[model samples]
Target: MDLQQMRYVVAVAETRNFTRAAERCFVVQSSLSHRIAGLERELGVRLFARSSRRVDLTDAGAAFLVGARECLAAADRAVADAAAATGVVRGRLAVGVIVTTAAVDVPELLQRYRARHPDVHVVLRPGHSAELAAAIRNGDLDIAFLGLPESERPSGVESVVLDHDKHVLVVQAEHRLAGASQVALREITEETFVDFAHGSPGRAQSDEAFAAAGLVREVAYEAGAGELMTRLIARGLGVALLPSAFIRPLAADNPELALVPVVDGPRRIEWLAWSRFNPSPATRAMLDVLGVVRHA
Candidate 1:
């Protein structure tokens, strides 16, 4: 019935543990439990099914949470709006980014944003391109930086194209084509490859390139992370096609690694995406800062 109770419920739902939720809300476990018990009674719904080992939201709790999050968001927006009227921006800004974001200096942008709006709380997380795009559209993230193929863009979100980049083939120095200035896709189709997970946006660029060229590749290792893929390429586990910016520095430090331009390699586009629907004040402020950074 109260905002505090809603906060308690939301916290418990997220952490799925009363004690952890209390810790997050800076309250005692007993007090949080009593409040949630009172809230469930007032609402006439069983919000959570409890056990000694685990807690899960009931069906009614799932439905209630949908409205609860909206109410909390609206309330936070009202507070942020009041602050904005006085030339202060105060709220949380959650930013998601691809693991290999090459366009736009994120740290510098965050630095400028923090200097401009000292009251805002900023959080950054890394995810794959499609995952970051989904977070932007779902209102879980205020904004995100993503790299997808030039032929594609995140759907249902407002986005700006930051830059386009070509991929290069990475091979160990002992590899056959490591000394080559450049190589075509067909030339490397028979070579064992290290690639991102199948169907991932990072993998798609190279996958589509081969498919378009009517070639098939042999992938011997599938790395879930960019650094792992780079290490595999350096170890002679297999060669990989990666964005030039991301691979250049790694190849520089490891003399055993060679970056050969893929003359017919796939290109990727970096995008800055945000929610198209009612975005929060903090989100809008971040977008404004991004506009300045983009032009600067």
Candidate 2:
């Protein structure tokens, strides 16, 4: 019925123990029980099945938990909105970005963003672009940096191109072709290639580059993350193609891995994506500072 009640229900559902939930909610166990009892009485259904040893949600409770959490989240957003209404942008802004971007001075950008908007708290969640897109759509992320295909922009979302990221081939220094100034994509089609996993942002770009070159690469290994790709290449597993930014740190530290430029690889365009609907002021400030907003 109220935010406190909704918070209590959510905590109980998450912890599944009245005492634990009470501790999490920062209230006494009996108070938590009383609140649940009141919520159940008001809703005309028991929200939880309780015993001395454990607790479980009723079918009705399971359904109510979803709505209760939504209500709590909405209330929290309302509070944030009220705080931002004072003409000072102050609230939590959740940002999602690909791990690859972390390698390329994103922390510097965040530092500049925070310096300008000191009151806004920016929470960075690093994942693949696909996962970041889903999080943005689900309201879990306020904004995200993704390698979104220009043709597949989601409905009700807005995007702006951030940078053109070049994809390059990585090989062990001892490889025969490592000394090449620039290797054409066709040259590596016959060579064993360390490929990024299917459905990853970088993988899509890699595939596009290979397809554009009309080259069919034999995947000698597939890696989940860029770091894994670098590590595998360092161990002489095979060669991989990734953004040039990804190899900068590794190239500096390791003398054995050569990051060769891909002569015909497709360039990945990075985009800053956000919902087009009403955005929080904190979110707006972040986009403006990031130069993601275009002038009309």
Candidate 3:
């Protein structure tokens, strides 16, 4: 019935818990619950299926949430547009970044953006590319830096390529393949692998490359961070396919690690993505500062 109520609905839907949603919205749990109940009654439909453990949206709730998100986005854009008209860019910009990418100069970009729009508040969340893509699609993030295949980007989002880096095979210095300049996927198929979790973008790309070569790798260990993966490799755990940019600097300090190019591996394309819908003025300003122009 109101923007505040819509925000409450969206926050609850995103967090999936009344207590956490209230915390996110800076309201008391009882007040959030009461308002949501009033909203459900006013709409003549339940927005959420309550439970002791977790909250789930019913079919009706899911249907209503789509419009709720659009409405909230519109409201935000209206305010941002008004501020822009006044020659001021002011609002919260929620940004998501892939955890293992070295291609993006996030710190420098943030510094410049902050200097240009001192009034705008920027919040950064780090996650795997898939998780960041999901957050951007859910309206939880205004923009994100993601590692995606050039041809298979997420739907409902517009993206610009920020940079490209190739995946390389990392091994301990004494490993048999360490002396090789470039190794084929099949050559390393039988070697124990250390890689990102199964669903992560990096892991998915590596898996697809091997699958394309008619080879399957046994993942002996999984790590979420490139540093941990390097540490694992240095400890002689197994070989891994990681971004060359990520491994190069670390390899400089660790003499025992080797970085060999994967002959036909996937290239990691880093993209800055935002909703193709009406993006907020803050989002647009940052994108402009980053030298990306969104097409209509």
Candidate 4:
């Protein structure tokens, strides 16, 4: 009924011993017993069974325990909500970052965030766009970097377009297309390709660009990691259509790989996402550090 009564009942249910529960509740044993009796009288149910050696919940008490826990949790959440409303950003912030960006700048951003907000606990989870999107929608991730599907952004998500990454072609230097100054999308359609696995945002973008150009490139290898895909390409398995950034350093050092710009390719939109209904100050602070402004 009252907060104090709920507290007393929950304590007794937890300890199953009147004396121990009283100690835990910081009340006298007799006071704890009186409070539980008062609660049982109000509810019109026998809430507990007591004997010389043990204390146990009655059938009704077991059912009431569930509601008691829920009420306590609600009270705790109310207190937490009040604390967060004052802009005191100190709590757990879970982020879901895509695999490719995780290897690039997300770590740097998270490092800077931790340095700035030492009191905040950061949990970084790496996932692809679809998984990240689902995590945000399911309340598993506080924020995520997602690649929204074209013509179909999922409902009830707050997201901002971070950037548009251009797609580029990666091939071994000794390949026939390498000798050419710049190869067209149609020109490389016949060449073998190292592609992203199905359901990936990159794979979808690659398909979109190739379809636009009316070209269907042959996929010789399909893999998860970019480094692994590049390695496969290096072995002369096939070429790959990847973000321009991933291929930059490899092109500079490795004489075997040529990072050529895709003259015709669809652009991939990078998005930063959070739930529409669950906005926490900690997540807002992290988003600010990452230079993302929230959009509906």
Candidate 5:
């Protein structure tokens, strides 16, 4: 019946608990429950299947939530646009990032963005490139910073190329390849490897390089983060393929880890992706700060 009631239903649905939902919405549990109860009575339908342990949305509630979310998004956009017209950019800016990338210093960049637009709410979601790109297409993220292989480009969204770099081999101090100045991918075929999860953008480059050379290397470990991958290599668990720019900052801190140039290495491409349909003013400002002259 009201936007506030719809918000309560949404919060309860997402959290699946009245207490947590109330906490998230900054309301008392009793007030939130009373509000939803009134809404259910007004709509002539039970919105939730309540229990002692958890709460689940009824079929009607599920249907209602879809419209509720859309209405909320539209309302937010209206408010944001009105503010933009007054030369004040005030809105939520959800950003997705590929963790451990060296294409651009994200913290410093965001610091500048925050300084300029203090009214905007900035949310950071660190994830894999593919996941970030999907979020951009889904309108879950206002913008994203992605790193994919040179052989591939992000599809389904407008994006710009920011940087290009190559991969390097990471090994333990005592590993056979550690003493070598540089080595070919073929020479390390027998060595166990550590890499990003299969089918991931980060994994694709390493996978493609070996596939192109008609060789199969065993990736004994899958690391979600660069620090974890370097740690695994330091323990002699497996050698890894890392970005060239990332090696310098990591080598001193991880003394047990050594970097060896790969004669034939996979190339990385960094991209900045934004929504093709109505990017927020905050998103545009952030891109402007990044020197993104125009959308792709």
Candidate 6:
């Protein structure tokens, strides 16, 4: 019946727990439950099947959730439109950035954006590419920078390619192939490899390259951060296929690591993505600052 009630329903449906939903909505559990129950009574339909352990949406609840989300989004758009009509680009902008070596100098970009829009409040969230993409799709984030495979980009979002990141083979300087300017996937097929964790775009690209060459590589270690992986390689743990931008700076600082171009490796494209639905004025201002125009 009310926007707040619709928000409570959608939050509960998404989280599947009353307490967690209440926490996200910044309300007490008892209050959220009472309001939802009141809403159910008003509609003469049970929205949720609640138990101690879990909260499950009823059939009617599932049907109502879709419209509830649309209504909330529209309401938010109306508020944003009103703010925009006032000609004030002042609002909270939630931004997500994957923790990786960025080609675009993100800190500088943020500094410039802040300088231009002094009234806008910016909140930065660091996360993995997949997690950030999910947050953007869920409307938790206004925009995110993600390293995504061109073929596997999520739907219902608009994206602009910020950088094309290439992968290179890195090894200890004393390794057999350290002096080589370029190497192929087949050349390192039998070597011990240090790779990023499974499900990461870097790891996926490395796997795809080996698979394309009909090669099976032995992964001796897996690390989440490029710095950790580089450390493992510097200790002669194993060779790794890492983003060129990530290892290049390390290679300059540490003479122990050598980076060689991968002659036939997949390039990971870093994209700045946002929801295709109505975006706030602050979000649009950010896109403009970044020189990205969303397509219709």
lDDT (tens digit, per residue) of candidate 4 on 1-296: 78888888888888989898999988999988988898889899999998999889999999988888778756754654676777556767889877566233777887898887777788888777887878888767788876543534545678777666676788888887776666678878888888777777768878877877777777767787788887887889899888775567666787888877767765667777888875776777887897776665
What lDDT does candidate 5 reach at residue 20?
94
Residues 1-296 of candidate 1: C-alpha lDDT, one tens digit per residue: 98899899899999999999999999999999999999999989899999999999999999989899999988988999899888889999999978778787789999999999999999998888888888888788889998898789889888888888999998988888988989999999989999988889999999999999999999989887878988887788899999998778777888888889988899999988888887777888888887724221
**Candidate 5: misplaced stretches above 4 Å?**
none
Pick by lDDT: 1 or 2, better one: 1
- Per model, state how many residue pairs clash: 0, 0, 0, 0, 0, 0
TM-score of each: 0.94, 0.88, 0.77, 0.69, 0.96, 0.74
Candidate 5 shows a clash count of 0
Which residue pairs in model 3 clash with each other? none
Q: Please estimate how well model 5 matches the true structure, expressed as its whole-model Cα lDDT.
A: 0.89
lDDT of each: 0.88, 0.79, 0.86, 0.77, 0.89, 0.85
Clash pairs, model 2 backbone: none
Which ranges of candidate 6 are over 4 A from the true structure? 10-31, 50-56, 90-98, 118-142, 146-159, 179-182, 197-201, 211-215, 220-224, 250-256, 263-266, 275-279, 293-296
**Considering summed lDDT, which 10 consecutive residues are worst modelled in model 2?**
148-157
Predicted candidate 3 versus true structure: per-residue lDDT over 31-122, tens digit per residue: 99999999999999999998889899999999999999889877877887899999999888999987666776789999999899998989
The residue pairs in collision within model 6 are: none
**Candidate RMSDs in order:** 2.3, 2.6, 3.9, 8.4, 1.4, 4.1
Better of 1 and 3 by TM-score: 1
What would the per-residue lDDT of candidate 5 be over residues 15-82, giving only the tens digit for each residue? 99999999999999999999999999999999999888779999999999999998888888889889
Q: Per-residue error at 66 for model 6, in Å? A: 3.6
For model 2, the superposed segments whose C-alpha errors exceed 4 Å read 50-56, 102-104, 149-155, 294-296
Q: Model 4 — which ten-residue stretch has the worst lDDT? A: 147-156
lDDT of 6 by residue, 228-292 (tens): 88889999999998778767877899999998898887578888889887788889989989988
